[model samples]
Target: MSKVSLKGLLSSRGPSALRSLRGGAASALSDGERLAMLDELEKSGLGWFWASDAEGRLTYISSAIAERLDVPLADLLGQPMTTIFTAAEREGRAKSLSLMLGAHKAFTGMAVRATRRPDGAVLRLAGQPVFGTGGRFAGFRGTGADISEEFHREEETARLARYDSLTGLSNRHRMAHQIDSTLTAFRAAKRNCAVMMLDLDRFKHVNDTLGHAAGDELLKQVAERLTRAIDRECEIGRLGGDEFQVMIPDVDDRGVLGELAAKIIAMLRQPYSLDDGRCVIGASVGIAIAPHDGVTCEEIVRAADLALYAAKNGGRGQYRFFSGELENETIFRRRLEQHLGEALREEQLFLRYEPIVDAAAQTVQAVEAHVCWNHSERGIIDEEEFAQIVEGSSLIGDVGMWAIREACRRAVLWPDSVRIAVNVPVPLFLSENFVGEIEGALTEAGLTPGRLELEISEAVFFGETSIVDRTLANLFKLGVRMTLDEFGSGYSSLAYLRRAPFDSIKIDQKLVAEAERHDSRELGLVRAIVALAGALQMDTIANGIESAPLLAVLSDCGVRYLQGPIFSEPVDQDVLEQEIADGSWKIDPGAERTRRARRRTVFRKIEIFHDDYAYEVTLRNLSRTGALIQGLANVPKGTQFVVDLGGGQLAVATVTRSSGDTQGLEFEQSLVDDGSGGLCTRNRVSPYALASAGTPLAALAPGSYQGMVGGLIDQGGAPKFGYAPGGRGD
Candidate 1:
């Protein structure tokens, strides 16, 4: 309709009609004045007014909109309102526009994008339902305003809130809300969800040495790897700093989660190429499952955090499942950390040397320096435990420098030909004064630089190339040999060999240990590494060679140097000096090769039973095959009994040797290997079994599974052996 026709309609309806149309905002204005104001508002270009008939066809629209839509008013007037304006995708308000129009209900501020506009225009529509005299449904008469700019601005704001600026992954806030919503829904559905908390092991070192730009670049690369490693359905978020979280829905199996965690760790541990830096960082993951581990956000997150702490504590580059035990252990770890600082300050720390011998020459050519803590109150602490206590702490660098200095000092007492191999932590190796520190130690100790070999881990290869190369060159110029330690443990990048100036490769103990387990694939991998090292003109040393068979295998595989318990445990500096004075010491690789099961001389009390009686026997020596039990007086040679190995693990054993209160019992079936290199039973006594036996339980606790043993113990009867009630009388 023309402007003259609109004015005529308002005049025909009088001022009362205009007042109702304006919602009484301009009630004092006359009919002609209101009509002029409405006409001017439509022509102002700020907004447009539209009227649709009962069938949803546009009866009237501002002439400007009709022109903007590239159609004449007559042609546009007959078209369906839905055809002219459609809901923009993902706009919440616009999605329900059609439904609201269909309901003939009054609605306001419904956002919709114009279908005919070329610029992808968004409009906000507000209208009240227009009814006929009979109260019958007519159509909507709404005002539309251009909100395209505001719409995009809101969208960008939302994106910023949800995404990480650096890696473009989800941010922590988004992850928290996502996890909260998912867990809530999953809990109602009685399904499971898992959360993995990961932290980069050496990320801070990258930031400190190469600057935050390289660290940010490294994190971006890490995020990309994480995306590839995790399932597409899983939600990954950068939880600030070097921390990240992954949410996997419909997964509760520890085994599957473990594999996923391993994949993530392996992928992230790969070398990252920054602008001018080659960065490598390892990740530790802690996984928590819903219902089993926790049910709510805080509970699950805390569980995962605890598990992550445990993983880092158990030495980085590993994953751990959340368990109740970690709660108590975390407190102990804090105490250990505090004590470690004191130990370093009080000079209670000492060094032990494990000889790295040439398998072919049968001579000790070098010794790897291991730091040990002689805690005044806690006795001797092993390297693994101490490493866990000091990892990610400032004390590590102090201890590392001390180890390097002490090793150099001690090397002066050894033969000039004997080299001292001291481990260089990634943090220490990337430090600004690493080369200076090495030179200072060598100068102070009066030791030649060549005699002080530096053992650098594969991790050090993942930093700024210029710095790492410069550090390596400086050490090389000083005549120090750089051996790449733990070669295959992380990325096993052949790229390191191509670019790095490593003089030798220390084959990771895992590969050697895996070879002993009869894994042909692992054996082939070890051989391949040795062959690769040989091709590169770098010597390969096999570590963790405890078995003679593995030793023979390594020797046959053409490995030159070897280190492990087979030769000797790491000895003190005094003993090391004595060994060096004795000249070359060698391990006899052919020394009585045996496949004997590893036996632990544990003196703990264990339950053994035969027939209807259970005996509290003292475990002397235990192995996968059998156990030596004391306190069983008249046990026959072939007497059969079940031994409770704690944690619901039970083994049926038969007495093979018996003398007085001591008997050697053999297991009916072999025990299965625990993932941690420990042993557990192939089958466990189920909680259902315990319940069926009329003994109900909430959960099985350690040592509480004694009741799970079949048959009743004759507790009222006389003692089985002639020993004190609490004493193991030998």
Candidate 2:
């Protein structure tokens, strides 16, 4: 019967099938017969068919339709199809029916659940619309099928594809699509947007300690927290393990983006309770805004990635924004790094020496060696441009060591009295081989420790005092004098001043220039520093004394050493030696002598003793009396001590006060010991020594008697004594 039914359907092609089902051929069928045939067909198969008029009223329904709806055919026909459909299906079915009628074609795959009448048995409908003869819009008919299992299977597949299995949130694939679409819309609208890529810092630590399951739970919780943190205007997506991306649309102010980044950082900083509240993780975020950081998707992603790298480099638990300056700086640094390796190998680097002069003495006491690079094509590259790159690399230590060695070698060529002060990078000081390098340089150059002063910027003493202390101690043990460079510009910790093994401090040029302006604050600061340095027994070098007024001011402040362009520009070794030879390089010796005299006058006497020797020292005159006594360790009290008064005169001294190692003496007698008694006698004890008999011993180095009794007497004014004792008469 099934085969006969199929054969009948196939043989009666086109509209003949409908006509055959009506009873016979189209010419023999009546309308009543056709309707009766449709009813019979519905009873024959599990499928159902329905015919609706143009107005959507059912003119006829198969018996199967009545069975599917659990109703009689009479009750189903001549009724609106809406009665058989749910609210959603009613609209869908109506649209399908209208489309099929308008197109005058059969429509299929209209699915719905319908209840049979009386018994109320449920059936799934998959139906099609039917066209009348000559392609006229007539009615709709289709089959009903059971598809409950199929519907669930399709939904499960979609769920797995779109969501993260662990967090139930949109995964990377879905988020990427969403981001692309959103960005396209933003671009079309000419609106600005931002993309933030975040990575959880130290997330692995939690996973390793708490297991992968706990890690999964933590990620789930993190997703929820992040979603809650963002506003509805933003979309958050998980870009796989420990990384997330957020898209912010219609953003106006970048500050708001920064604020959002800060907020995210803050939120992430809060402890994440996982594994029953035992695990925690922090997050770092990098943000890139459109039309500024980048224009296209790839560019934005790359910018965000760079920003992320910067954030991680800056340290975790923070956020950074993409900046054009940062990008340029990064590129510049990379180029510099690439060139720096070759620069060292090619010996493109050289040293420039700036003389550290004693302003009062007008002598080059030391030369500060500064590093300079003469690029083959770029001409001169300033230190500020590449200093940071050098500092952050291993090259800093190597370059610093090289500087020390070169400076020492050059220093050995200078006068024995000239010291070379080499600037040392802080990292070099911390290097384990720093001491060895210094020793090697010293040995190679045969430079004395006293002549090799290490000038360190004040920044070195700021961190890890113990390390600085140890480094200073090691340098001191090597007999290397330390000078604080750029003194006032740095932290200038008083504690470091007291603890570090520093022998001198160079007043920064800024302070010195300000002091020259008659700036009270600056001058006062300089004075205070000078006083402090004096108290600490540290030598003070006033740097950047450019103007004569400033020099005068420095002199008044009792600054003994100074270096600047006003005095003498930094000259090459040959020029410096020529200047020294010409005697035109003379500085005012009077100022330095005056300063020393003042300092000496303050001290009563310095009785230095070696072993069990003692000498009674007497202060003759502060301006000219020699500071040292030779027989202080052996001469007895009350013995006629004939002191050699330089140009062949003898000054007799008697001990007046005697202590264990110190003694006070008085000039008791004077005589010409050159076997002559005339004024021109080679040796003569003059009245100047007698007049200075009661003076304190401290004034001896710069005493007036020596100035008067020296070989050449200044007879322009009051008759100065000839060859007075303790003067540079010889």
Candidate 3:
């Protein structure tokens, strides 16, 4: 019915080819000429003809198409049409190829990919069923042309539309579409999905200090690292600037989510080597689970945002699960940010000094100055409580310079042997007057340059090569010693050490803890750092040595300076003066300085449920990992009990040790800090869940949940383990 004239007699390749077939002599050419022209057209690489028998076997295929497909015409002639063309989407071309052939119907414009073409050679095909004189159906005769070039162009355009050009990760639009589609499908199936929001810390600082080129380079590296870090099934995307989103399907357990978040943070925190210089950055993660946190995309995203804000407020480089209280916490952080500038103006801030000691001699080497706020109403707030808040403030430069000046002013009054060290913030260290400010502080207090130490982190290296190099050279010539603060917390690049004249390396405290807890490769890394520092004629300091095991390991590993609560907590100037008033202060290596997991002794009566029976118990002690409860008799190990810790909190725990009237319960999921020096569950049973159980989500009696959840009302028998007289609270 439809016809296209041969432009050059044509050619065949991947699809089908015209062999001995001839078109109707519609033109002025004779039948032989017309047939010759059609054959020439097939060989011109434009189009080809193919025919199949009644059994759907390729009965004839032109030599041009066979040559294009890299097969002999004889080989392609007898192959099944379905076997000759295969596609990834078997639903369309492949399925229809089989179905349409069997249906004995004409099909036009069927696009399919050749089975043998790894280059994804596509062909547009049109076919008509052939019938004999008796009207018995034969197979199909068709013409197809390769459309690989056009297909690849359209695919590239679509990829550019959905992917980030800079990072090659999914773009914001694609991520949003994916989240929406996944959540919708999952909602009906009653499955859980989770969303994680991650924002890079100090990314803008990198852009401001280094050039935009460096920032772009940093983002690409980040994408690669993120891909490697997230081994689970998920989609990672860049949602513009330094923000990223991760959609994880079929995950709702906060404990598992916490570990994954921690892994990502750890990976991102490692220092990155760039052409500009080596730099280290961190990420804060906020997570929200579907249906549990929200039922819609908007709701889930907002929940994740609130959680992210809370993580930033808590200190960057941490993860937080969404909770109802995060909304209020985010607002309070905003209020706190506004008040920070006021705190500075009102002189509500003070300084405390924590000593970094030479562990072998048990003598103080240097005391680092820290900022503390004495709010008129909120009492005292430490640096950890407000660090991230200050980092985001416009007054970071002012605050950094103040700490340096104040530390010098106070240290000038101490004995000459007691050197003072001050922390340098990223923004302040990059400011124009950074070196000038330090010089003025030293001059004003009559403090010798040698007696002052500048503690700088890897973040300072984000500046331009010339600027960072110039700044370091100027400071080194000024006669002050420099220490790399929080080493291994971020970019632990040996590249920086190769050039920067740091007098010492302060190992990140968390690195030490992680190394000791797991005896992981981190311990080897710590040793390598110590060896490297020793070779470079630099000292290595490992802080936060809490336990005896940790201290012993660090000591044996040749760490030069150790600082932790085990040595002495940060102290007021008055306390420091009292300790060193006579001579050089010395602390003997004693068991008292190291920290042990703090257990709070509690004598409160609570309820524990087992097998739908509730037993009144007295809580003897509580810790983050576990709890001890009295008032149960003959409780066997491995039994699970839900502890009602009052105020709608329920903790799932298992009995690890059972003695006569007391049981030590190990929590299935560890407790999280409640921010008031207490422990609480990360997530609580929501009112919606209660409502789903047939009760209205309103103000019900204190014990109303017991009947709905524990079936306590239906139980008329005594509990399995009755309360014993000795287990009662005194």
Candidate 4:
């Protein structure tokens, strides 16, 4: 190695610097002797010395250091220093090592990496600018010490801090930091982002039944699947336990987000093959878009959380988009949960059995027990309330057992030919007293065990399966009829059917709806399920057959038990007793030939745009495909308008039916759920779109559009149609 140049600095600083450069003993040595000592130091491996010419290309480097880098000293001599060493990001003393060199200034302890080393060696460099005889800049001379060991230790520590040990995905701290920084950076750019929050449904059941190790494996599999399912760029993190968060950058369309959310849910719902056994769990997704939901990480995460809770309460296995009403809905659900126990105590909880008629005989062969609540404040609480309050509450076990006993008590009074199928929640089915509760219900009612069917979902398989198998065996010995509910929905297993003693299998309602929708492989799955059930000597039950065409199709596929609106809605015991008093009940299916979408009654005011004019109308009822509005007069069939359903939700609709001042509208684009039992357009009119019209980029406020207002009011245009005169109806 060349001698570290000290003569230029010594001449600049005079005798004091010379004395400082050479210690008392070394001062007696000549310049040649001092250079010899420096050469010996460079030969040692403790550290290496390097000198670059004015062009920043390496002129002289220790041959020992070149050996470590696995390059010949001659090859490194002419190469740029940047090619050999690059600044380490962890120690950003300068933006870059090249910058300090460009400034011709001194730098010390700047961490760097060896570019060609297979061992990934790290080095801490200290350097100062060198000058020649004329005081003109020459180049740089630097000393570098190996720091690879320390650097690796710190890097492993950081990896542990930022990643989950189980899933190897980002932990909570990393997720929070990434979300915060991304939102802060995107704020000025006005770019939108979406966050999806998910938690495994019945995940606790898995932990309780299988071991925690199995649960860990399931989480790893879930993380892998999540990584594969996302086609776009995203950051997925596990926020502890079964909860996960996905931050998708630069996407705000509810249509796109909703589809992605649904896709994630579907992927997560698939059965996981683990060491324990086949475990099937579900996921619920709650999404929130940035700037609209919140501008900060905490706000968006909280919003997504609220939406997730709503999805769980609404019944698991669904995705819900966040809205302003989520907080209120959450509070309402909590209140209902608190009152559910009282409702049970006061006998407000009751069962309504929807008859499952035999497809071939057209006779009521069995009825499924559906629980309903009679809340004093809400009059008659619907099934939605029951799902959000009763089933989701801590008292699920108590409510579930009560329903079993009550259904038995009621079924005992029914005709012997008809059976009663009661849904068994996973927690209650796994409870220690589960078998005893069923035995007690049967004994107290003095009902035949075979007449009371226990409809168990596949989630029951996710728990300590030995106990589950024992429970099933005991129930079988007790002669309690068992039906596998929603078998083909997610947990599609021939092993469960072969091992468990199921008297029948329940077809998922989705397949039935799909059969009504189209002639696709979904129907093939149904036929296969029916065929398999037949070979197993088990009957098949198809639920949610709402239309005549669906009923005919299911009948052709050999489904024995049929239930849905095509027959009748769930009725109270009194009505059932009256219908089957003569010990025989047969009913005709409805005359409806095709399936129709269910409409939600919503009497709210909305705006409709026609030919640049806005008309105020009262929205009577809304569905995914259509809505009814009554306000403007003389709007004939085939007329088109843009309907605004608030929150920037706009749908282009054409009038399909017309009456005096009342018209039925068919939406070109379907609506999506707002997580609050309301319908909204799939895609909203973005504020960025408004910016093109000279409006500022911001969140859409709750009101009519400013552009629409100017055109409707300032133009002095005549009214398009005469408004209905106000009377008591207004």
Candidate 5:
């Protein structure tokens, strides 16, 4: 043990022993010397040796590992080698240890994690198959070196590449690859995959008001909410900066996709309390289905992106499914936006007024000024279309100020009692000189400030609290009545009502439209809003009152003023002035009768089937559960027929009334909502079902086939009744 003794021992050691220790070449050393060298190597604890039998059972293991693993040598011997070492380990490349041992192949530098060792050592293993002199299958002998630290470092590097550092979700690159791979695999399997593109609404506002740090924190919370909202085996990724994408596999049902999209929108809209302040934002989702919307990654993603753009343009905070019509809409919107800048300069923009009638007095109370754009080519674009074009544009303020001035000027020509109401967008109303602009318009037009009403939306609540409050207070002090527009259309806050001092609330047309339906809850909501308005000393204006029944309901509900198609469509300034000069415009109390179902007039060809024979008839009107058909002569009452609506929609109906060539038929089943302002059959003819029935279908192409056994009839032979080009038969 002394230094002199150790020096003498090393001096006596042969060159062969040193060479064997260095593993240069095999030395002709005695068995005792070889055993001593192996013991010295095991004692060094830098490396370990392992061997397995032909059965993949551990036969030998270094004592150092055995001691480190805290397992007795007898306990480890004859155990499955896979039990001691984890499965496929990843170094530069990954190879399954069990597979390599089973194949008896040579492998090296496989980073394997030790399962038995409590220290969780990652060992770099090198193994070569050993065979007997007879060339029989033998076992594996491998050397392992601990590389846990190195493995973790490499894993961290890989993690950075695949995940978002801020949110810890998949990054853009990873999401794209994931969608591509999933869609590719699902395409071959004839499965469906859906991709949803989400954009956070008002995220930039938060980032601007608070800071990037708060925005980042908000995104983390959004990611968490998304993960919880989906609750499916889908890939959710942050596609950088408030845009996220979700790849859902094996889901093609629009209903399910819509529900998920709604859930995500709702979850993200909840208020987030950051370190600085509380903020709320919404999400818009665009969904595209594989093989239907597109097949390729770019195609599908582009489709979804277009849908997202449409959703955002459609007034934000909603989900839209990709359809062929959306592309045209997007293009039209872009062109309209371009044209909108020139609208005011070219004198194409003008204001029209729809009369607001006092329900009790049955007299004109006010007229809302709606901006109308008469495109040279398109001719009379809807207000909504113009809104979509001007939304979020600087030109909106110009146009808005022009409208205010023009409406004030127009109001000067009207009778003293009739007031003029002009809608003020949140941006325009919150502008620095909004109050000054109102005053300027009034002073220039020589109109009373009280007659000029500024209609503001609840979105003003989302702006700077103090600024919005001050702006509204200043407007109120300017002798202008400030009415809250589109009440209940979004997050209507009680705090906003209590703080800003609004004079009236316009019940959103959506609520009014829904109240006309059979939904009692919507009616109750309308009643509550009216009662709430009354309690706050604010008047309620029922909007979109197209039906006489809705008018009666609102009148009975004590709604003070009304504005809709029922009273009048927006008229030019001349008509509005003439109506005002001709005394008062009173709405007829008994304007129309109430009906159970809403009917839309139509003039299109519809195929009718009776006793295996198809007849071509003109559809004069349509409802959810019935339709009136002309050109079908002598169709007796109670005769059953199948009406072929377009897009594989079929409705079985029985004739309830017949007079000559005109007949009314009642549907066997009610139609479901098409999500747009239309009705469709709940079920459609599936391509797979058609293929299963021996029909050759590449996909569900448009058009109908007459005289085909399984296809819906498009046309029929000469009809029993005389053919009429118009709905009425001679």
Candidate 6:
């Protein structure tokens, strides 16, 4: 193409003209033509334009350049380009000019800013150098545009991405990225850092009860407070909905970090002024230190999370540092979770009976069934070790059902007068299906609802009060007695005491245990709790009574019941039953001996009949209370019988109670001694008449009586005889 034609095409083209200039006809133009071509290019609508000679002087300047500087083009031509730039841009522009003139190379897309002479409007300029005629630097030409608006837009977009729109604080995404980068830098430098995860405790309640608008205002205020508390060296972020993260970079001493955390806690301790004039909320902080507690971002976050859980679990609004002990506890908890399914399926869980004694009666009133796990290797694990695992897992409801069923089954075996209290997990208490499970268990076990007591921890009351009220109301409707466990440990003391349908409140061991040891605040606390329970017309059971002094204190405090090792240790069901029987059983020689002789005669023959199928026997020495058969064969209880007399005569007999080979039989009519000693006697004389002879038959011997009566009493205590029919033995 001709030089003028090429220059016209390049000028007519846009930024794409630079690509064509790289290796095409635009390079074949003469130096003057290139300069003239550059001069013509300045008239294009893009922006200011300029041309430089091979000597690095300004050869041509377009009217647009003068207009950008607010000067005439005739006054700007033939001046070195460096003269047009400000002192700041002169050196850079001069270097570009030198490179173009010395090496015949072209440069493009060099961004520079210039100020207009009169109005001082800021203008962005981009320049390119042109070469021609034996590879000489003919001129430098470029365009510029006003990009202030574009620059501002880019900055605004970046700000929105990094900051939370609601609170105007860094969001979790940006915080995470910054923390990760900080950790990487710290690791390379072998430095230490700390991360704090904060949870606004009970913030949800405020939102639900007060309103979301109020909650939003509260969060904004919290963010402001946090920002003011932290310095430029530290960064704070809102990790979505009442949770926040703080990063303290380059922390060498952990104590310093702790002090900082303490400061944060103290700052949060001051009440937050919510939109609702005076409502306040508190925050819990969990701290994890890098290189000490964790080495990676995830590890640090997890450690902080665990510490946060510990803080909340220890009753919120506090701060805790990640420790080795907590890590070990976490591992132990994971192990428990791993094995919990098997434990539930294999029936490895059992109950221990903690006796609840009636302080007034000074007798064992009832036993509370405390579930325990008999781990094969770990021995017995405490509730704290596995209860949370059960609660946090889907197994909570299943485990609760199993506990209720097993407790009911074992409880039915207890003496009818003694009620058995079983601890129902808090989740079970909240579940809608809890009442159905209890009803089903009671039906299957044939246990009365009055005999079964369900114990629930005080934590349930501290939860959603509405939920607690509804759940407890349903449970009460099921006729199950409810005892509030760990009564004084929760916040909603008076509220729960007034609202819940609790039959009793067991004083938490903490207050009771300290009541005897210390005479100060703890004693007063216990006394207050007892007084509260009493005022509410609810029974109070003093727990953790280890010493007589504590019991005495409990008694003095007017506590109705006491539980702990002081009265009786938690024992197995069989052991508890044996203990109760041992304490209550009496020995009577005369009555026992007579009963035994009759029982032995009856049982021995019953055994013979059972072994040989001999079904008939004669009962002599009959009385209103009992009857003895002299020529009777052993028969099982419940067997119908017709006693044959003489000719077509007959007497109907029914087995009432049996012992081994002998059976206690009831006849429709009492057998009377005819005194004739004729056919009625017939080799079977009444044992009473024989005893009167003073040469009583072997059936009337005291030795046989003792053996039979003893055996009968033993069998009577068996669970299988729950509803055995009584029999009067002659």
lDDT of each: 0.76, 0.60, 0.77, 0.79, 0.76, 0.61
Order the candidate numbers by TM-score, best to worst. 4, 3, 5, 1, 6, 2
User: What is the C-alpha lDDT profile of model 2 across 210-272, one tens digit per residue?
Assistant: 778888888988888888788758877787899988888867344566567767765664556
What is candidate 4's lDDT per residue for 1-730, written digit by digit as tens? 3332444444554654444334334466776576566667767777577767888988766766766666767677777888777777652343577787788888887777677764566778777777768988888877777777897888778888999988888999999999999999988787898999998988887888788988999999999999998999999999999999999999987878877877887788888899987687889889988877788999999999988988888878888998777888788878988998899899998888799899888999888888889889867776555765665788998888888999899889888999888998889999998999899999999999999999998777766769989999999999999999987786678878876999999998876778764569888888999999999999999888778888888898899989888888788888999999999899888575456777887777777766555677889999989999988777767776677776556677888998988899998778776644567776655555555565443433333343431122222332244456320111
Model 2 off-target regions past 4 Å?
1-53, 57-104, 111-126, 131-136, 328-730
Compared with the true structure, model 5 gives a TM-score of 0.73
Candidate 2 structure lDDT: 0.60
Worst 10 residues of 4 by lDDT: 709-718
Report how far residue 275 has shifted in candidate 6, in Å: 8.9
lDDT of 4 at 5: 40
Off by over 4 Å in 6: 1-211, 214-237, 246-287, 295-299, 306-342, 358-363, 375-380, 457-471, 508-522, 544-556, 564-570, 583-730
Q: Would you list the rank order by lDDT, best first?
A: 4, 3, 1, 5, 6, 2
Per-candidate Cα RMSD to the true structure, in Å, reads: 7.8, 32.1, 6.6, 5.2, 7.3, 29.3
Best by TM-score, which number?
4
TM-score for model 6? 0.46
Better structure of 4 and 6 per lDDT: 4
Worst 10 residues of 1 by lDDT: 710-719
- Report the C-alpha displacement of residue 337, candidate 3, in angstroms: 1.8
- The estimated TM-scores of all candidates read 0.67, 0.38, 0.81, 0.83, 0.73, 0.46
Q: Write the residue-wise lDDT of candidate 6 on 399-470 in tens digits.
A: 777878988898787777778887776667777666778889999999999888888876565356677787
Best by lDDT: 4
- The local lDDT score (0 to 100) that residue 602 gets in candidate 3 is 75
